[model samples]
Structure formats: structure tokens, C-alpha cells
Target: MFHIVFVEPRIPPNTGNAIRLSAATGADLHLVEPLGFSMTDAQLRRAGLDYHDLASVTVHPGLDALWQALLPARVFAFTASATTSYADIAYRRGDVLVFGPEPTGLDARVLEHPDVTDRLRIPMLPGRRSLNLANSAAIAAYEAWRQLDFAAP
Candidate 1:
């Protein structure tokens, strides 16, 4: 399975929806702290995610810890500023597909990290801020799955 890493995720509902997506797709979901809301919030639960969704979610204390756990996996960060489209990358098992928080996006330091395998973006009309967080994740994940032929099935 591929890894889906959300960096400093802010909105509960976005993360919640992402949880459902991750579970259905069999991707491991990793949340890097500090998150803006409690994962236990009722709104999170109301976002169509059930307790089973949490089974695929893993909370890491910080980026450092996340890196330690997910080491050796190439990370392709999804950012609006990236010149390369997400489709250009060849994703493999153990590759990490990372998304930034909703409000501000990934921190510059993290985005420029030497360990980041690549920076990618989903093409949009000029002047658009971005696509919705959950929507972006779904698109990227599905494309990666497609590249893998949806994993033999």
C-alpha cells in the first residue's frame, strides 16, 4: 500500500473525509502534528467517517518522527506552487504522497527539506489558490493507483 501523509492538517472534516478515502483505498494515513482540531470532535465523526476509518490513521508527533517511521520511502509533496504535475511521478509501493494543511499549505522548511523526493501540483487555472484538500488527495491517490493498475485488481 502507498502512504498518505497530511502535514499539520487543520480542519477536522477534511481530515475525516481523507480518513475515509484512505481506508477505502487501503493507503496508510499519517497525520503530522500539531493538528488544528481533535480527531475525536463530533464534526469529524459527522463527516461520514466511522470508527473503522481510524484503523488506517496513524498520528505522528512531528515531521521528524514521521520521517523516522517512513524513512527510505520517496515522498512526493503536493503543493500549488510546484511546476511538476503529480502525474509525472512514478509512484511505487512504500512511496509517500503528502498533502499540506488547508489554511496555509506546507511549511517552507518542510517543503524544501532535502529528503523530499519531489514536489508536485495538480494543474489548475491561473490565480486559483487550490483545490479542496480532500479532493486533491483523492485525485492524487487515484492517479497513483491507476499507475499501479489499481494494484492487480
Candidate 2:
């Protein structure tokens, strides 16, 4: 029941890959406004995400729309500057795992929003750049699912 949210994602392939991850994990996928490409974009649909994977995808005009639709679920912002590692958080069902854009990352305003429960980071090599957005989201989602004992029927 976890929700994977991407804020103003800039790359189509990354988002497409995320959609596949969502479908595989049974997580709802939310995409915020100002996307770099359309859902019908050829590249996007061809990036290993099939139409079935898009079944659970939801497009929000803005963060406010997402807020309204996903209320009561705590949002955990994933940022490179965070002090707490993502694994340290006791993730729960229905929590929203929020990620940022490819190059610029999350907006400070969004990261600091009152609704965001906490900021989390993945430990990386010292002085290294951030991991690819899709990879980071997969790692976070898998860890959260792991903590849930790989929930399944």
C-alpha cells in the first residue's frame, strides 16, 4: 500500500522505470505536474513499462492535488542532504515515499513542507554525486517492502 511519488520529474525513462517498479511491488504511483514528457510519449511507453504497469499510475496537476487525494498518508521526502538514512525510518503501509527531479532534486520548499514527516537519504560513497533517481526509488521501495516482510497474499 505504499505510494511512490515523483515531484516534477524531468526524465521520461526514469519515471517509466519507476512505474514498472510500482507495478511489480503493488505500490501506487503518483506523478506531480510539469513533467518533461507526456505519458503517450513513445520513449516513455517503451522504457520497459507496459500499459498494464500504467494501470496504477495517477497523474496530479500539482502537489495540492496529490495532497488532497492522498491525505492521511505521511510523506517522507528523499533528499541527498538529509541526515537520516532511509532504512532507519520505520516505514508503514500507506506512507508516501517522495522523490525529486533528476538534476535539480527536490525543491527546498517542498522538502521543508509541514506535511513531510521527515527527510531520508541513502548512504553513498563520500563526496560522490547522488544515485540515479530510478535506482534510488527502487532501493527505497524494496527496503520498505522488506521491512513489511514482503507483503503478499
Candidate 3:
């Protein structure tokens, strides 16, 4: 399975959608705080994610803790500034796909993190900023899953 990590997420519905994506793809979800909303917030529930859909999620206090837990795996930072396409890489099982918050994408410090294996971006129209958080994760996760031939555990 792949690992989807959201750093300092600032939206509830996006994360709720990610939870559903995680459930559907069997890819684990990891969130780094401080989140914009509580896990129990009504907005999250309103997105239609339920307890079972959240089973694959794991919340981390910070990036440091996340590195410790997910070491020995390739962590790709998704950023608009990246020169490499997300599809260029040969994804393997247990790879980690990391995304930044909504309003602003990943900061320079995060892109420079030692644990981050490389940077990637999804192609978009010229002058367009970026895709929705949940949508980006879904795109990358589906690509990786497809590369693995949609294997099941």
C-alpha cells in the first residue's frame, strides 16, 4: 500500500475526502498537525466520511514524528515548483506521497527536508496554481496503485 501524508492540513472536507480515498485505495493516510479542524468537527462528518473510512488514517504530531514512523520509505513532496512530474517516478509499494496545506503549498523548508526523497508535480494548465488537495492525492495514489497493477492485500 502507499502512504498519503498531508502536512498541516487547513480544511475539513478535503481531509474527509482523503479518508474516503484512503479507504477506497487501501493506502494509509497520515496527517500532520495543527489541523484546521478537529477530527470530530461537524464539517468533517458532513463530508460523509465515517468511522470505517477513517480506519487507515494515522495522525502525527509533527514532521519529525512522521519521519520516525515512516523512515525507510520514499517520501515524495508534491509541489507546483517541482520540475519532475509525479508520474515520472516508478512507484513502489509502501511509497509515501506528501502534500502541503491548501492556501499555500509546501514551504521551502519542507521541500528541503532530508527525509523527502524527491519532489513531484501534477501537470496543469499554464498559469493555473494547483489542484484541490484531495484531488491531487487521489490522482497520485491512483497512479501508484495502477503501477502496482491494483494489487490487493
Candidate 4:
């Protein structure tokens, strides 16, 4: 399974949907704080429904901690400004798909991190802003999974 890293996410419903995504895809979710809402947030739980316990979700205090834990993995930071398309990559089992906060997206510093193998983007029609956080994650996750033929028994 792939690793989904959400850095400084501010929206509860988005994170909740991501939790569901993790459970459905067998991907682990890593959240870098400081988060805008509590893990026990009702809205989040409601959005995730009964899948929270089924997903492997971990929260890290900061980016350093996240980097330390996910070292040696191919980390692909997703951003709308990137030149590379998300579908162009040959994703592996342990690859890390890193996303930024919903409001601001990934900072320039985070995007330039030495650990990031590349910055990727999902193509959209002309003049569009961006897709929702969870939607973007689902798109990337399913694309990677599809590349591997779904890898289900």
C-alpha cells in the first residue's frame, strides 16, 4: 500500500474522507500538525463514518518527525503548480504521496524539500483552481493502484 501524507490540514470533512480513502485502499494516512481540528471532531467522525478504526492514521508533531519516519521512501509532493503529471509516475508499493493543506496548499519550502522525488499535479480544465483535498488523494491513490493492476487477491 502507498502512504498518504497530509501536511497541516485544516478541514475536518476533508480529513475524514481521507480516512475513508485510506481504509478502502489499504493506504496509511500521515497527518503533520498543527491541525485545525481535533481527531475526535464529530464532523470528521461523521464523514469517515465507521471506517476510522479500519484505517491506519498517524499524526506527527511536525515535518521533521514525518521526514524521520518516512526516510528512504520516494516522496512525491502533489501541487497544482507542478510541471509533472501525477499519472506519469511509476508508483511503487511504499511510495509516499504528500499533499498540502486545503487552503494554502504546500509551501514553497516544503515543495523544495530534498526528500521530495518530484512534484506532481492532476490536470484540470482551463481556469480551474484545484480539486478538493480528499478528491485529489483518491484520484492519485486509485491511479497508482490501477498502475499495479489493483493488487487485490
Candidate 5:
């Protein structure tokens, strides 16, 4: 399983859907907060996530805290400006797949962060800005899982 990190997510259902994704895929979901909605543990569970799904999500106070927990792992920051397509990478288990907020993608600082092994992007048509937050994550997650033969214990 991989780790899906969402930075400063603004939407509620996007994160809720991600919880379900994590539960199904066995990928742990990490949220860097100052979140757009009130996201208490009970609130998350009430959002239709069972205890198992909620257990797959971890909310960090900030990027620094996220780094503390996920470092020494290959971090791939997804951004539209990235030259590398998401499919080009040979993703592996434990690799951290990072995404930004809904409106704007990853900030320059994050893309340039030393810990980021590289920056990646999901291909799109000529004029598209980006895909939905949860959608992009699912695409990448499925691809990575596919490469890993979709292993499950």
C-alpha cells in the first residue's frame, strides 16, 4: 500500500471519498490541515465512514508535521507544471503520493522541496486546468496498485 497525502484540502466530500478509497485500496490517507471543514474524528465517522475507513485517515496539523511522519520515503508532488507524466514513474509501495488543494495545485515551495524525489502530473487535454482532487488521487492510486499487482494481505 501507498500513502496518499492531501495538502490543505478544502472540500468535504473529496476527503470523505478519499477515506473510502483508502479503505478499499489499503493506502493510508494523510491530510495536512488547516482544513476547510471541521474534521473531528467523530465527525469523520459520522460522514458515513466506518471505524475501519476512519482508521485509514490521519490528519496532520501542517506540512512540517506531515514530513515528520512520512519522511525517508520517496515523495512525489503532483502539479500541472510538472514535465513528468504520472504514468512514467515506476511507483512502489511506501512511496508517498502528494496532492495539493482543490483550487490551486501544489505550491512552488512544495514542488521544490528537497524531500520530493520528483514532481508528477496526470495528463489532460489541451486547455484543462486540472481534475477533481479525489479523482486525481484515485487515478494515481489505481495505477500504482496496478503496478504492484494489487497486492493485499
Candidate 6:
């Protein structure tokens, strides 16, 4: 399974959607705090619907803790500033796909982390800013899963 890491995510609904995405794709979701909202936020619950129990979601106190827990895995930091496209990588199982918060993307420090294997971007129209956080994550997760043939046994 792939790991999806959201660093300092600020939106409740986006995180909620990510929860549903994780459950659907069998991917693990890790969130780095300070989260903008509580896990039990009403918006989060509404977006996640009944998939909360099915999702594998973990919360890390900080970036250091997240790094410590997920070290030795190939970490791809998703950022709009990245030159490399997200689809270019030959993603492997257990790889960590990292994304930043809604308003501002990954911080420079996080992007420059030693653990990050590469910075990647999803393609967009010439002047467009970015896709929704949850949408981007779902795209990355599904692409990785697609490369793994969905891992059906």
C-alpha cells in the first residue's frame, strides 16, 4: 500500500475526502499537525460519511515525528513548484506520497527534507494554480495503484 501524507492540512472537508480515498484505495493516510480542525469536526464527518472505520488514518504531532515514522521509504513531496511531473515516477509499493496544506503548499523546509526522494507536480493549464487537495491526493494514489496493477490477489 502507498502512504499519503498531508502536512499541516487546513481544511476539514479535504481531509475527510482523503479519508474516503484512503479507504477506497487501501492507502494509509498520515496527517502532520497543527490541523486546522478537529478529527471529529462535523464537516469532516459529513465528507467522510461511513468510511471512517475503513480508512487507515494516523496523525503525527509534527514533521519530525512523521519523518521518524516513515523514514527509509521513498517520499515524494507534491508541490506546484516542482518541475518533475507526478506521473513520471515509477512508484513502488509502500512509497510515501506527501502533500501540503490547502492555502499554501509545502514549506521549503519540508520540500528540502532529506527524506524526500523528489518533488512532484500534477500538470495543469498554463496559468492555473492547483487542483483541490483531496483531488490531487486521489489522483496520486490511484496512479500509484494503477502502476501496481491494483495489487489484487
TM-scores, all models, native as reference: 0.94, 0.95, 0.95, 0.97, 0.91, 0.98
Candidate 2 local lDDT, 1-153, one digit each (tens): 799999998899898888888878888889999899988877778774564544488999998898999987788999999999998999889999999998878998789888999999999999987999989999999998998899951
Give candidate 5 regions above 4 Å deviation: 40-55
Task: Write model 1 residue lDDT over 1-153, tens digit each, in one string.
Answer: 898889998888888888887767878889999998987877777773564544488899999999999988898988998999998888898889889998688878778988899999999998999898889999988988888888732
Candidate 6 stretches with Cα past 4 Å from truth are: none
| Candidate with better TM-score, 5 vs 6 | 6
Clashing pairs in 3: none
Candidate 5 residue-wise lDDT at 54: 39
> In candidate 1, which residue ranges exceed 4 Å CA deviation?
51-55
Candidate 6 lDDT, 62-125, residue by residue in tens = 9999989988899999999999999999999889999999889999999999888999999999
Off by over 4 Å in 4: none
Residue 20, model 4, lDDT:
98
lDDT per residue (tens digit) for residues 1-153 in model 4? 889999999999999999999999888999999998999999999999999989999999999999999888999999999999998999998899999998789998889999899999999998998999999999999998888788851
Encode model 3's per-residue lDDT on 1-153: one tens digit a residue: 989999999999998888888888889999998899999988777774564454488999998899999998999999999999998999999999999999898998789998889999999999999999999999999999999999973
**Between which residue pairs do clashes occur in model 4?**
none
Q: Please say which candidate is ahead in TM-score: 2 or 6.
A: 6
List per-prediction Cα lDDT, in the order shown. 0.85, 0.87, 0.90, 0.94, 0.87, 0.94
lDDT of 3: 0.90
Q: Between candidates 3 and 4, which one is better according to TM-score?
A: 4
Better of 1 and 5 by lDDT: 5
